[model samples]
Target: MAGSGETSEARALGEALAALRRDCGLSQAEAGARIGMTGQGWGLYEAGKRSSLFRPDVQRRLTGALGATPEALMLQAPGGAAVSTDRPKTSHPDNAPAHGLSARGRAFEGAASDVRRLRLETDELAPWASAGTVLEYALGRWPRRGQGCVIQLQDGLRKVRLYDRADEAEMVVLGAGALDRSERIARSDVQSVSAVISRLDDA
Candidate 1:
Protein backbone atom coordinates (compact mmCIF):
# COMPACT_ATOMS: atom_id res chain seq x y z
CA MET A 1 0.00 0.00 0.00
CA ALA A 2 1.11 3.56 -0.69
CA GLY A 3 1.77 5.59 2.35
CA SER A 4 -0.41 8.74 2.20
CA GLY A 5 2.70 10.74 1.37
CA GLU A 6 4.48 8.27 -0.92
CA THR A 7 2.89 9.23 -4.20
CA SER A 8 3.32 12.93 -3.48
CA GLU A 9 6.90 12.40 -2.46
CA ALA A 10 7.52 10.42 -5.66
CA ARG A 11 6.17 13.31 -7.68
CA ALA A 12 8.52 15.53 -5.74
CA LEU A 13 11.33 13.33 -6.95
CA GLY A 14 10.14 13.99 -10.47
CA GLU A 15 10.20 17.69 -9.61
CA ALA A 16 13.75 17.19 -8.49
CA LEU A 17 14.57 15.75 -11.88
CA ALA A 18 13.10 18.84 -13.53
CA ALA A 19 15.04 21.20 -11.27
CA LEU A 20 18.24 19.37 -11.96
CA ARG A 21 17.74 19.90 -15.67
CA ARG A 22 17.10 23.60 -15.21
CA ASP A 23 20.12 23.98 -12.93
CA CYS A 24 22.20 22.59 -15.74
CA GLY A 25 20.83 25.57 -17.75
CA LEU A 26 19.37 23.47 -20.54
CA SER A 27 15.85 23.92 -21.92
CA GLN A 28 13.57 20.85 -21.87
CA ALA A 29 13.98 20.54 -25.63
CA GLU A 30 17.72 20.88 -25.35
CA ALA A 31 17.97 18.49 -22.47
CA GLY A 32 15.65 15.99 -24.07
CA ALA A 33 17.42 16.46 -27.38
CA ARG A 34 20.58 15.15 -25.81
CA ILE A 35 18.49 12.22 -24.64
CA GLY A 36 15.83 11.22 -27.16
CA MET A 37 12.27 11.99 -25.88
CA THR A 38 12.42 15.67 -26.91
CA GLY A 39 11.47 18.56 -24.61
CA GLN A 40 7.90 17.24 -24.64
CA GLY A 41 9.17 13.93 -23.34
CA TRP A 42 11.04 15.70 -20.55
CA GLY A 43 7.92 17.59 -19.46
CA LEU A 44 5.80 14.44 -19.43
CA TYR A 45 8.41 12.51 -17.51
CA GLU A 46 8.74 15.10 -14.76
CA ALA A 47 5.16 16.37 -14.42
CA GLY A 48 3.19 13.20 -15.02
CA LYS A 49 4.74 10.59 -12.82
CA ARG A 50 1.85 8.32 -13.73
CA SER A 51 3.43 7.52 -17.08
CA SER A 52 6.76 5.93 -16.33
CA LEU A 53 7.56 3.50 -19.14
CA PHE A 54 10.77 4.91 -20.47
CA ARG A 55 13.46 3.23 -22.50
CA PRO A 56 16.64 2.24 -20.75
CA ASP A 57 18.61 4.78 -22.73
CA VAL A 58 16.19 7.50 -21.70
CA GLN A 59 16.47 6.41 -18.06
CA ARG A 60 20.23 6.55 -18.24
CA ARG A 61 20.13 10.06 -19.71
CA LEU A 62 17.70 11.34 -17.09
CA THR A 63 19.67 9.75 -14.29
CA GLY A 64 22.79 11.53 -15.49
CA ALA A 65 20.95 14.83 -15.93
CA LEU A 66 19.36 14.74 -12.46
CA GLY A 67 22.61 14.07 -10.63
CA ALA A 68 20.58 11.71 -8.45
CA THR A 69 20.96 8.00 -8.03
CA PRO A 70 18.38 5.87 -9.83
CA GLU A 71 17.44 4.32 -6.50
CA ALA A 72 16.66 7.75 -5.09
CA LEU A 73 14.29 8.54 -7.95
CA MET A 74 12.48 5.21 -7.83
CA LEU A 75 11.95 4.81 -4.09
CA GLN A 76 8.86 2.80 -3.11
CA ALA A 77 7.20 2.71 -6.53
CA PRO A 78 4.14 0.46 -6.46
CA GLY A 79 4.79 -0.94 -9.93
CA GLY A 80 8.33 -1.01 -8.68
CA ALA A 81 11.20 1.40 -8.83
CA ALA A 82 12.13 1.97 -12.49
CA VAL A 83 15.56 0.70 -13.36
CA SER A 84 17.43 -0.55 -16.41
CA THR A 85 19.42 -3.03 -14.42
CA ASP A 86 18.91 -6.74 -14.78
CA ARG A 87 17.00 -8.46 -11.98
CA PRO A 88 19.09 -9.39 -8.97
CA LYS A 89 19.94 -13.06 -8.99
CA THR A 90 18.48 -15.10 -6.14
CA SER A 91 20.58 -16.36 -3.25
CA HIS A 92 19.87 -18.15 0.05
CA PRO A 93 22.28 -16.40 2.37
CA ASP A 94 20.24 -17.53 5.35
CA ASN A 95 20.74 -21.25 5.92
CA ALA A 96 17.51 -23.19 5.75
CA PRO A 97 15.62 -24.01 8.91
CA ALA A 98 16.04 -27.71 9.78
CA HIS A 99 14.01 -28.71 6.76
CA GLY A 100 14.79 -31.70 4.54
CA LEU A 101 15.26 -29.58 1.41
CA SER A 102 18.70 -28.21 0.57
CA ALA A 103 19.21 -24.50 -0.15
CA ARG A 104 18.86 -25.12 -3.90
CA GLY A 105 15.73 -27.20 -3.34
CA ARG A 106 14.23 -24.57 -1.08
CA ALA A 107 14.46 -21.82 -3.71
CA PHE A 108 10.95 -22.45 -5.01
CA GLU A 109 9.70 -24.48 -2.03
CA GLY A 110 8.16 -21.48 -0.29
CA ALA A 111 7.15 -18.03 -1.49
CA ALA A 112 8.99 -16.68 -4.48
CA SER A 113 11.03 -13.58 -3.58
CA ASP A 114 10.64 -11.64 -6.77
CA VAL A 115 7.54 -10.28 -8.48
CA ARG A 116 5.41 -13.39 -7.81
CA ARG A 117 6.28 -13.18 -4.14
CA LEU A 118 4.67 -9.76 -4.11
CA ARG A 119 1.35 -11.26 -5.24
CA LEU A 120 1.05 -13.90 -2.55
CA GLU A 121 -0.42 -12.00 0.40
CA THR A 122 -2.23 -14.85 2.11
CA ASP A 123 -1.17 -18.22 3.37
CA GLU A 124 -4.37 -19.73 1.97
CA LEU A 125 -4.10 -17.74 -1.29
CA ALA A 126 -6.24 -14.71 -2.01
CA PRO A 127 -8.72 -14.47 -4.88
CA TRP A 128 -7.75 -10.88 -5.61
CA ALA A 129 -4.55 -8.92 -5.75
CA SER A 130 -2.95 -8.55 -2.34
CA ALA A 131 -0.07 -6.43 -1.05
CA GLY A 132 2.70 -8.31 -2.82
CA THR A 133 0.75 -10.53 -5.20
CA VAL A 134 0.27 -10.58 -8.93
CA LEU A 135 -2.81 -12.46 -10.04
CA GLU A 136 -2.41 -16.12 -10.86
CA TYR A 137 -2.47 -16.62 -14.63
CA ALA A 138 -3.45 -19.21 -17.21
CA LEU A 139 -2.31 -19.36 -20.83
CA GLY A 140 -4.95 -19.94 -23.51
CA ARG A 141 -6.79 -18.23 -26.36
CA TRP A 142 -10.40 -17.06 -26.54
CA PRO A 143 -10.84 -15.67 -30.08
CA ARG A 144 -8.08 -13.25 -30.73
CA ARG A 145 -4.55 -14.47 -30.22
CA GLY A 146 -4.54 -18.22 -30.41
CA GLN A 147 -1.09 -18.34 -28.93
CA GLY A 148 -2.45 -17.82 -25.39
CA CYS A 149 -3.88 -15.46 -22.78
CA VAL A 150 -3.10 -14.58 -19.18
CA ILE A 151 -6.01 -14.74 -16.74
CA GLN A 152 -6.28 -14.33 -12.98
CA LEU A 153 -7.05 -17.67 -11.35
CA GLN A 154 -5.95 -20.37 -8.94
CA ASP A 155 -5.32 -24.06 -8.74
CA GLY A 156 -7.47 -26.38 -6.66
CA LEU A 157 -6.64 -29.86 -5.22
CA ARG A 158 -3.10 -29.35 -6.52
CA LYS A 159 -4.15 -30.45 -9.95
CA VAL A 160 -6.23 -27.63 -11.47
CA ARG A 161 -5.90 -24.00 -12.46
CA LEU A 162 -8.89 -21.69 -12.92
CA TYR A 163 -9.75 -18.68 -15.02
CA ASP A 164 -11.93 -16.73 -12.61
CA ARG A 165 -12.11 -13.65 -14.83
CA ALA A 166 -13.62 -15.51 -17.78
CA ASP A 167 -17.23 -14.49 -17.16
CA GLU A 168 -17.98 -18.22 -17.02
CA ALA A 169 -17.01 -20.61 -14.28
CA GLU A 170 -14.09 -22.03 -16.19
CA MET A 171 -11.43 -23.93 -14.33
CA VAL A 172 -8.46 -25.88 -15.56
CA VAL A 173 -9.57 -29.46 -15.05
CA LEU A 174 -6.82 -31.86 -14.06
CA GLY A 175 -7.09 -35.54 -13.24
CA ALA A 176 -6.27 -38.97 -14.58
CA GLY A 177 -9.32 -40.19 -16.56
CA ALA A 178 -12.04 -37.84 -17.95
CA LEU A 179 -9.68 -34.89 -17.55
CA ASP A 180 -7.48 -36.30 -20.29
CA ARG A 181 -10.17 -35.17 -22.74
CA SER A 182 -10.17 -31.50 -21.71
CA GLU A 183 -6.41 -31.44 -21.55
CA ARG A 184 -6.40 -32.53 -25.16
CA ILE A 185 -8.85 -29.80 -26.17
CA ALA A 186 -6.78 -27.21 -24.33
CA ARG A 187 -3.87 -28.10 -26.53
CA SER A 188 -5.93 -27.18 -29.59
CA ASP A 189 -9.32 -25.49 -30.36
CA VAL A 190 -10.75 -25.43 -26.86
CA GLN A 191 -13.83 -23.21 -26.75
CA SER A 192 -14.57 -23.18 -23.02
CA VAL A 193 -12.99 -24.55 -19.89
CA SER A 194 -14.76 -26.88 -17.43
CA ALA A 195 -15.72 -25.81 -13.95
CA VAL A 196 -14.82 -28.27 -11.21
CA ILE A 197 -15.42 -26.23 -8.06
CA SER A 198 -19.18 -26.69 -8.31
CA ARG A 199 -18.95 -30.34 -7.33
CA LEU A 200 -16.30 -29.69 -4.71
CA ASP A 201 -18.19 -26.85 -3.06
CA ASP A 202 -19.36 -29.05 -0.19
CA ALA A 203 -15.93 -30.50 0.27
Candidate 2:
Protein backbone atom coordinates (compact mmCIF):
# COMPACT_ATOMS: atom_id res chain seq x y z
CA MET A 1 0.00 0.00 0.00
CA ALA A 2 2.79 2.40 0.87
CA GLY A 3 4.58 1.65 -2.40
CA SER A 4 1.40 2.33 -4.32
CA GLY A 5 0.89 5.62 -2.51
CA GLU A 6 4.40 6.76 -3.33
CA THR A 7 3.93 5.89 -6.96
CA SER A 8 0.68 7.82 -7.08
CA GLU A 9 2.25 10.91 -5.52
CA ALA A 10 5.20 10.80 -7.90
CA ARG A 11 2.90 10.54 -10.85
CA ALA A 12 0.93 13.52 -9.67
CA LEU A 13 4.08 15.58 -9.24
CA GLY A 14 5.26 14.54 -12.67
CA GLU A 15 1.97 15.58 -14.19
CA ALA A 16 2.26 18.95 -12.53
CA LEU A 17 5.76 19.39 -13.95
CA ALA A 18 4.52 18.48 -17.40
CA ALA A 19 1.71 21.00 -17.09
CA LEU A 20 4.10 23.78 -16.15
CA ARG A 21 6.39 22.95 -19.06
CA ARG A 22 3.48 23.11 -21.52
CA ASP A 23 2.37 26.42 -20.08
CA CYS A 24 5.79 27.80 -20.90
CA GLY A 25 5.45 26.56 -24.50
CA LEU A 26 8.41 24.21 -24.24
CA SER A 27 8.84 20.70 -25.61
CA GLN A 28 10.29 17.89 -23.51
CA ALA A 29 13.57 18.20 -25.39
CA GLU A 30 13.68 21.94 -25.00
CA ALA A 31 13.04 21.74 -21.27
CA GLY A 32 15.63 19.05 -20.87
CA ALA A 33 18.23 20.90 -22.94
CA ARG A 34 17.82 23.92 -20.73
CA ILE A 35 19.13 21.83 -17.83
CA GLY A 36 21.70 19.82 -19.80
CA MET A 37 19.62 16.65 -19.70
CA THR A 38 18.35 14.40 -22.45
CA GLY A 39 14.70 14.35 -23.46
CA GLN A 40 14.48 10.76 -22.27
CA GLY A 41 15.85 11.75 -18.88
CA TRP A 42 13.32 14.53 -18.59
CA GLY A 43 10.59 12.07 -19.60
CA LEU A 44 11.63 9.87 -16.72
CA TYR A 45 10.76 12.71 -14.39
CA GLU A 46 7.39 13.10 -16.04
CA ALA A 47 6.84 9.35 -15.84
CA GLY A 48 7.49 9.45 -12.08
CA LYS A 49 10.36 7.03 -12.33
CA ARG A 50 13.06 9.38 -11.07
CA SER A 51 13.40 9.54 -7.33
CA SER A 52 15.23 12.87 -7.56
CA LEU A 53 11.92 14.49 -8.42
CA PHE A 54 11.09 14.40 -4.74
CA ARG A 55 14.03 16.59 -3.76
CA PRO A 56 13.53 20.31 -3.36
CA ASP A 57 16.69 21.06 -5.32
CA VAL A 58 15.53 18.87 -8.17
CA GLN A 59 12.11 20.49 -8.08
CA ARG A 60 13.68 23.92 -8.32
CA ARG A 61 15.92 22.87 -11.18
CA LEU A 62 13.06 21.38 -13.15
CA THR A 63 10.69 24.29 -12.57
CA GLY A 64 13.41 26.84 -13.20
CA ALA A 65 14.14 25.27 -16.55
CA LEU A 66 10.47 25.87 -17.42
CA GLY A 67 10.70 29.48 -16.21
CA ALA A 68 8.45 28.50 -13.29
CA THR A 69 8.76 28.29 -9.54
CA PRO A 70 8.32 25.39 -7.16
CA GLU A 71 5.20 27.05 -5.80
CA ALA A 72 3.66 27.00 -9.25
CA LEU A 73 4.46 23.32 -9.52
CA MET A 74 2.61 22.50 -6.30
CA LEU A 75 -0.37 24.57 -7.35
CA GLN A 76 -0.48 22.60 -10.58
CA ALA A 77 -0.43 19.27 -8.76
CA PRO A 78 -3.58 17.19 -8.37
CA GLY A 79 -6.24 18.61 -6.02
CA GLY A 80 -4.49 21.98 -6.04
CA ALA A 81 -6.17 25.05 -7.48
CA ALA A 82 -5.20 28.66 -8.29
CA VAL A 83 -2.41 28.05 -10.78
CA SER A 84 -1.89 31.21 -12.85
CA THR A 85 -1.36 30.73 -16.55
CA ASP A 86 -0.53 34.24 -17.59
CA ARG A 87 2.24 34.78 -20.15
CA PRO A 88 4.59 37.69 -20.52
CA LYS A 89 3.65 40.66 -22.70
CA THR A 90 5.69 41.52 -25.75
CA SER A 91 7.94 44.47 -25.13
CA HIS A 92 7.41 46.12 -28.49
CA PRO A 93 4.86 46.24 -31.25
CA ASP A 94 5.20 43.74 -34.05
CA ASN A 95 5.43 46.57 -36.57
CA ALA A 96 8.61 47.95 -35.05
CA PRO A 97 11.27 48.97 -37.57
CA ALA A 98 13.03 45.97 -39.02
CA HIS A 99 16.39 47.74 -38.77
CA GLY A 100 15.98 48.41 -35.08
CA LEU A 101 17.20 45.98 -32.49
CA SER A 102 14.65 44.32 -30.23
CA ALA A 103 14.28 45.08 -26.55
CA ARG A 104 16.06 41.83 -25.80
CA GLY A 105 18.88 42.81 -28.10
CA ARG A 106 19.42 46.04 -26.23
CA ALA A 107 19.45 44.20 -22.93
CA PHE A 108 21.90 41.56 -24.10
CA GLU A 109 24.38 44.05 -25.46
CA GLY A 110 27.75 43.53 -23.75
CA ALA A 111 26.14 41.20 -21.19
CA ALA A 112 28.07 37.98 -21.21
CA SER A 113 25.83 35.65 -19.22
CA ASP A 114 22.51 33.98 -20.01
CA VAL A 115 23.04 34.33 -23.75
CA ARG A 116 24.43 31.88 -26.29
CA ARG A 117 26.47 33.05 -29.24
CA LEU A 118 26.94 31.48 -32.65
CA ARG A 119 29.26 32.56 -35.43
CA LEU A 120 28.17 31.92 -38.99
CA GLU A 121 30.79 29.95 -40.90
CA THR A 122 28.77 29.88 -44.12
CA ASP A 123 26.69 32.26 -46.18
CA GLU A 124 23.63 30.09 -45.78
CA LEU A 125 21.86 33.04 -44.17
CA ALA A 126 23.14 35.59 -46.69
CA PRO A 127 21.29 38.88 -47.22
CA TRP A 128 19.88 38.55 -43.71
CA ALA A 129 23.28 37.55 -42.34
CA SER A 130 26.45 36.50 -44.05
CA ALA A 131 29.41 34.34 -43.20
CA GLY A 132 31.43 35.74 -40.27
CA THR A 133 28.35 37.27 -38.66
CA VAL A 134 27.85 36.46 -35.01
CA LEU A 135 24.48 35.78 -33.46
CA GLU A 136 23.42 36.01 -29.85
CA TYR A 137 20.31 34.11 -28.88
CA ALA A 138 18.15 33.62 -25.83
CA LEU A 139 16.96 30.13 -25.03
CA GLY A 140 13.45 30.63 -23.71
CA ARG A 141 12.34 33.61 -25.78
CA TRP A 142 10.26 32.67 -28.77
CA PRO A 143 10.84 34.70 -31.91
CA ARG A 144 8.22 36.69 -33.79
CA ARG A 145 7.43 35.75 -37.35
CA GLY A 146 10.11 36.90 -39.81
CA GLN A 147 12.68 37.16 -37.04
CA GLY A 148 15.91 35.20 -37.01
CA CYS A 149 16.18 32.04 -34.94
CA VAL A 150 18.42 29.08 -34.31
CA ILE A 151 16.71 25.71 -34.38
CA GLN A 152 18.40 22.86 -32.56
CA LEU A 153 17.37 19.42 -33.70
CA GLN A 154 17.36 16.26 -31.60
CA ASP A 155 19.99 14.68 -33.82
CA GLY A 156 22.52 17.42 -32.92
CA LEU A 157 22.04 19.50 -36.05
CA ARG A 158 21.49 23.23 -35.62
CA LYS A 159 20.17 25.50 -38.34
CA VAL A 160 19.84 29.22 -38.64
CA ARG A 161 16.59 30.11 -40.29
CA LEU A 162 13.91 32.74 -40.57
CA TYR A 163 10.99 31.98 -38.29
CA ASP A 164 7.75 31.49 -40.17
CA ARG A 165 5.14 29.81 -37.98
CA ALA A 166 4.49 26.78 -35.85
CA ASP A 167 1.56 24.70 -34.74
CA GLU A 168 1.40 21.83 -32.28
CA ALA A 169 3.02 19.27 -34.55
CA GLU A 170 5.26 21.18 -36.93
CA MET A 171 7.18 24.39 -37.62
CA VAL A 172 7.81 26.10 -40.95
CA VAL A 173 10.91 28.13 -41.78
CA LEU A 174 12.57 29.92 -44.65
CA GLY A 175 16.01 28.54 -45.31
CA ALA A 176 18.88 30.48 -46.86
CA GLY A 177 20.71 30.18 -50.19
CA ALA A 178 19.38 27.90 -52.92
CA LEU A 179 17.65 26.06 -50.11
CA ASP A 180 15.66 29.23 -49.57
CA ARG A 181 12.51 27.22 -49.95
CA SER A 182 9.99 27.14 -47.14
CA GLU A 183 10.42 23.93 -45.23
CA ARG A 184 8.36 22.17 -42.61
CA ILE A 185 10.11 20.42 -39.74
CA ALA A 186 8.60 18.02 -37.26
CA ARG A 187 8.40 19.48 -33.79
CA SER A 188 9.26 16.19 -32.17
CA ASP A 189 12.63 16.29 -33.89
CA VAL A 190 13.39 19.76 -32.55
CA GLN A 191 15.19 20.28 -29.29
CA SER A 192 14.75 24.03 -29.12
CA VAL A 193 14.06 27.21 -31.17
CA SER A 194 15.97 30.07 -29.65
CA ALA A 195 15.33 33.64 -30.70
CA VAL A 196 18.33 35.41 -32.22
CA ILE A 197 18.33 38.52 -30.08
CA SER A 198 21.31 40.22 -31.71
CA ARG A 199 23.55 39.94 -34.73
CA LEU A 200 27.00 41.44 -35.24
CA ASP A 201 28.94 41.53 -38.45
CA ASP A 202 32.68 41.13 -38.55
CA ALA A 203 34.47 44.34 -39.38
Candidate 3:
Protein backbone atom coordinates (compact mmCIF):
# COMPACT_ATOMS: atom_id res chain seq x y z
CA MET A 1 0.00 0.00 0.00
CA ALA A 2 1.42 3.34 -1.02
CA GLY A 3 0.67 6.64 0.62
CA SER A 4 0.02 9.93 -1.16
CA GLY A 5 3.28 11.39 0.05
CA GLU A 6 5.28 8.54 -1.43
CA THR A 7 3.56 8.91 -4.77
CA SER A 8 4.44 12.57 -4.97
CA GLU A 9 8.04 11.80 -4.11
CA ALA A 10 8.27 9.17 -6.81
CA ARG A 11 6.96 11.63 -9.35
CA ALA A 12 9.60 14.13 -8.44
CA LEU A 13 12.36 11.56 -8.60
CA GLY A 14 11.20 10.35 -11.96
CA GLU A 15 11.33 13.85 -13.33
CA ALA A 16 14.85 14.23 -12.08
CA LEU A 17 15.94 11.05 -13.80
CA ALA A 18 14.32 12.16 -17.02
CA ALA A 19 16.01 15.55 -16.92
CA LEU A 20 19.39 14.02 -16.23
CA ARG A 21 19.14 11.58 -19.10
CA ARG A 22 18.11 14.37 -21.45
CA ASP A 23 21.05 16.41 -20.32
CA CYS A 24 23.26 13.55 -21.39
CA GLY A 25 21.72 13.73 -24.87
CA LEU A 26 20.47 10.17 -24.90
CA SER A 27 17.08 9.08 -26.17
CA GLN A 28 14.91 6.69 -24.22
CA ALA A 29 15.94 3.67 -26.30
CA GLU A 30 19.61 4.53 -26.19
CA ALA A 31 19.61 5.18 -22.47
CA GLY A 32 17.55 2.10 -21.78
CA ALA A 33 19.86 -0.07 -23.84
CA ARG A 34 22.80 1.02 -21.68
CA ILE A 35 20.78 -0.21 -18.73
CA GLY A 36 19.24 -3.37 -20.21
CA MET A 37 15.75 -1.95 -20.46
CA THR A 38 13.37 -1.23 -23.31
CA GLY A 39 12.52 2.32 -24.36
CA GLN A 40 8.98 1.98 -23.02
CA GLY A 41 10.21 0.48 -19.79
CA TRP A 42 12.69 3.28 -19.23
CA GLY A 43 10.01 5.79 -20.11
CA LEU A 44 7.88 4.39 -17.32
CA TYR A 45 10.58 5.13 -14.79
CA GLU A 46 10.95 8.66 -16.13
CA ALA A 47 7.19 9.14 -16.15
CA GLY A 48 7.02 8.31 -12.47
CA LYS A 49 4.69 5.42 -13.23
CA ARG A 50 6.54 2.64 -11.42
CA SER A 51 6.83 2.92 -7.66
CA SER A 52 9.78 0.52 -7.67
CA LEU A 53 11.86 3.30 -9.19
CA PHE A 54 12.23 4.70 -5.69
CA ARG A 55 14.18 1.76 -4.38
CA PRO A 56 17.73 2.74 -3.43
CA ASP A 57 19.31 -0.06 -5.44
CA VAL A 58 17.30 0.90 -8.49
CA GLN A 59 18.17 4.57 -7.98
CA ARG A 60 21.88 3.81 -7.71
CA ARG A 61 22.01 1.73 -10.85
CA LEU A 62 19.86 4.04 -12.93
CA THR A 63 21.85 7.09 -12.04
CA GLY A 64 25.14 5.24 -12.30
CA ALA A 65 24.27 4.36 -15.85
CA LEU A 66 23.92 8.06 -16.61
CA GLY A 67 27.32 8.82 -15.06
CA ALA A 68 25.69 10.42 -12.05
CA THR A 69 25.18 9.52 -8.42
CA PRO A 70 21.89 8.82 -6.70
CA GLU A 71 22.06 12.19 -4.99
CA ALA A 72 21.95 13.88 -8.37
CA LEU A 73 18.55 12.36 -9.12
CA MET A 74 16.83 13.57 -5.96
CA LEU A 75 14.00 16.01 -6.31
CA GLN A 76 13.84 19.33 -4.58
CA ALA A 77 11.59 19.68 -1.58
CA PRO A 78 9.19 22.43 -0.59
CA GLY A 79 10.78 25.91 -0.48
CA GLY A 80 13.55 24.53 -2.70
CA ALA A 81 15.17 22.26 -0.14
CA ALA A 82 17.00 19.25 -1.47
CA VAL A 83 15.86 15.72 -0.73
CA SER A 84 18.39 13.45 0.87
CA THR A 85 19.70 10.48 -1.04
CA ASP A 86 20.63 8.55 2.09
CA ARG A 87 19.32 5.02 2.44
CA PRO A 88 19.43 2.42 5.16
CA LYS A 89 21.97 -0.33 4.79
CA THR A 90 20.73 -3.70 3.61
CA SER A 91 21.73 -6.69 5.69
CA HIS A 92 21.97 -10.38 4.78
CA PRO A 93 23.11 -13.33 6.82
CA ASP A 94 26.30 -15.14 5.89
CA ASN A 95 24.38 -18.26 4.92
CA ALA A 96 21.70 -16.39 3.05
CA PRO A 97 21.41 -16.99 -0.68
CA ALA A 98 23.41 -14.51 -2.76
CA HIS A 99 21.52 -12.06 -4.97
CA GLY A 100 23.13 -13.08 -8.31
CA LEU A 101 26.16 -14.56 -10.12
CA SER A 102 28.20 -14.68 -13.31
CA ALA A 103 27.43 -17.27 -16.00
CA ARG A 104 30.53 -19.19 -14.93
CA GLY A 105 29.15 -19.77 -11.39
CA ARG A 106 31.69 -17.44 -9.82
CA ALA A 107 30.42 -15.14 -7.06
CA PHE A 108 30.06 -11.52 -8.18
CA GLU A 109 32.28 -9.35 -6.03
CA GLY A 110 31.22 -5.95 -4.55
CA ALA A 111 27.61 -6.30 -5.67
CA ALA A 112 26.39 -6.88 -2.11
CA SER A 113 25.54 -3.21 -1.71
CA ASP A 114 23.06 -2.43 -4.47
CA VAL A 115 23.65 -4.03 -7.86
CA ARG A 116 25.14 -7.39 -8.84
CA ARG A 117 27.48 -7.84 -11.81
CA LEU A 118 27.29 -10.85 -14.10
CA ARG A 119 29.68 -11.55 -16.95
CA LEU A 120 28.32 -13.16 -20.05
CA GLU A 121 30.23 -16.39 -20.64
CA THR A 122 28.17 -17.62 -23.59
CA ASP A 123 26.67 -16.23 -26.77
CA GLU A 124 23.10 -16.90 -25.67
CA LEU A 125 22.71 -13.19 -24.88
CA ALA A 126 24.72 -12.04 -27.88
CA PRO A 127 24.40 -8.70 -29.71
CA TRP A 128 22.35 -7.28 -26.87
CA ALA A 129 24.65 -8.64 -24.21
CA SER A 130 27.54 -10.42 -25.87
CA ALA A 131 30.12 -12.65 -24.25
CA GLY A 132 32.53 -10.66 -22.01
CA THR A 133 29.90 -8.02 -21.33
CA VAL A 134 29.26 -7.39 -17.66
CA LEU A 135 25.67 -6.76 -16.66
CA GLU A 136 24.52 -4.83 -13.59
CA TYR A 137 21.22 -5.78 -11.98
CA ALA A 138 19.14 -4.40 -9.14
CA LEU A 139 17.67 -6.77 -6.58
CA GLY A 140 13.96 -6.65 -5.70
CA ARG A 141 13.12 -4.69 -8.85
CA TRP A 142 10.94 -6.46 -11.39
CA PRO A 143 11.66 -5.82 -15.04
CA ARG A 144 8.89 -4.59 -17.29
CA ARG A 145 7.98 -6.28 -20.55
CA GLY A 146 10.82 -6.31 -23.12
CA GLN A 147 13.34 -5.56 -20.38
CA GLY A 148 16.17 -7.95 -19.63
CA CYS A 149 16.32 -9.68 -16.25
CA VAL A 150 18.35 -11.96 -14.05
CA ILE A 151 16.14 -14.73 -12.72
CA GLN A 152 17.11 -16.89 -9.78
CA LEU A 153 15.81 -20.45 -9.62
CA GLN A 154 15.02 -22.49 -6.54
CA ASP A 155 18.21 -24.50 -7.02
CA GLY A 156 20.29 -21.28 -6.71
CA LEU A 157 20.98 -20.93 -10.42
CA ARG A 158 20.53 -17.74 -12.40
CA LYS A 159 19.63 -17.05 -16.04
CA VAL A 160 19.55 -13.84 -18.04
CA ARG A 161 16.65 -13.32 -20.41
CA LEU A 162 14.19 -10.80 -21.72
CA TYR A 163 11.10 -10.82 -19.55
CA ASP A 164 7.83 -11.54 -21.32
CA ARG A 165 5.04 -12.19 -18.84
CA ALA A 166 3.90 -14.47 -16.04
CA ASP A 167 0.85 -16.10 -14.51
CA GLU A 168 0.05 -18.10 -11.42
CA ALA A 169 1.55 -21.27 -12.83
CA GLU A 170 4.47 -20.06 -14.95
CA MET A 171 6.77 -17.32 -16.23
CA VAL A 172 7.61 -16.54 -19.85
CA VAL A 173 11.01 -15.34 -21.02
CA LEU A 174 12.51 -14.63 -24.44
CA GLY A 175 15.98 -15.32 -25.73
CA ALA A 176 18.11 -12.37 -26.90
CA GLY A 177 18.16 -12.23 -30.72
CA ALA A 178 16.23 -11.31 -33.78
CA LEU A 179 14.13 -14.47 -33.48
CA ASP A 180 13.49 -13.80 -29.75
CA ARG A 181 12.27 -17.32 -29.02
CA SER A 182 10.24 -17.62 -25.84
CA GLU A 183 10.43 -20.22 -23.09
CA ARG A 184 8.03 -21.10 -20.34
CA ILE A 185 9.01 -22.22 -16.86
CA ALA A 186 6.90 -23.43 -14.01
CA ARG A 187 6.35 -20.73 -11.39
CA SER A 188 7.35 -23.17 -8.70
CA ASP A 189 10.83 -23.40 -10.19
CA VAL A 190 11.58 -19.70 -9.80
CA GLN A 191 12.78 -18.30 -6.51
CA SER A 192 13.16 -14.63 -7.47
CA VAL A 193 13.73 -12.16 -10.32
CA SER A 194 15.85 -9.02 -10.61
CA ALA A 195 15.95 -6.27 -13.21
CA VAL A 196 19.14 -5.90 -15.21
CA ILE A 197 20.03 -2.25 -14.70
CA SER A 198 23.13 -1.69 -16.84
CA ARG A 199 25.51 -3.27 -19.35
CA LEU A 200 29.26 -2.72 -19.36
CA ASP A 201 31.25 -3.85 -22.35
CA ASP A 202 34.40 -5.51 -21.10
CA ALA A 203 37.57 -4.61 -22.92
Per-model TM-score on C-alpha atoms: 0.30, 0.48, 0.46
Task: Write one digit per residue (lDDT tens) for candidate 3, span 124-202.
Answer: 8666788889999876355667778888898877789988776446778887443278888776787667778899997
lDDT of 2 at 131: 88
- Clashing pairs for predicted structure model 1, backbone only: 118-132, 118-133, 119-132, 119-133, 119-134, 140-149
Ranking 1 against 2 by TM-score, winner: 2
Tell me the lDDT of candidate 1.
0.35
The TM-score of candidate 3 is 0.46
CA-RMSD of model 1: 18.7
Q: Which regions in candidate 2 have their CA more than 4 angstroms from the true location?
A: 1-112, 176-180
What is the Å distance of residue 39 in model 3 from its true position? Answer: 22
Q: What digit string (tens of lDDT, one per residue) describes model 1 on residues 39-144?
A: 7877877773533423322343464333332443454233345422333312213442211101111112332231121133332321222234333322111111
CA RMSD of each candidate after superposition:
18.7, 12.7, 8.8
Against the true structure, whose lDDT is highest?
2
Regarding TM-score, does 1 or 3 come out ahead?
3
Backbone atom clashes (below 3 Å) for every candidate: 6, 0, 0
- lDDT tens digits, residue span 34-107, model 2: 55567898999999888678765466557756655455677789877333222222322434321111122222
Please rank every candidate by lDDT, starting with the best: 2, 3, 1
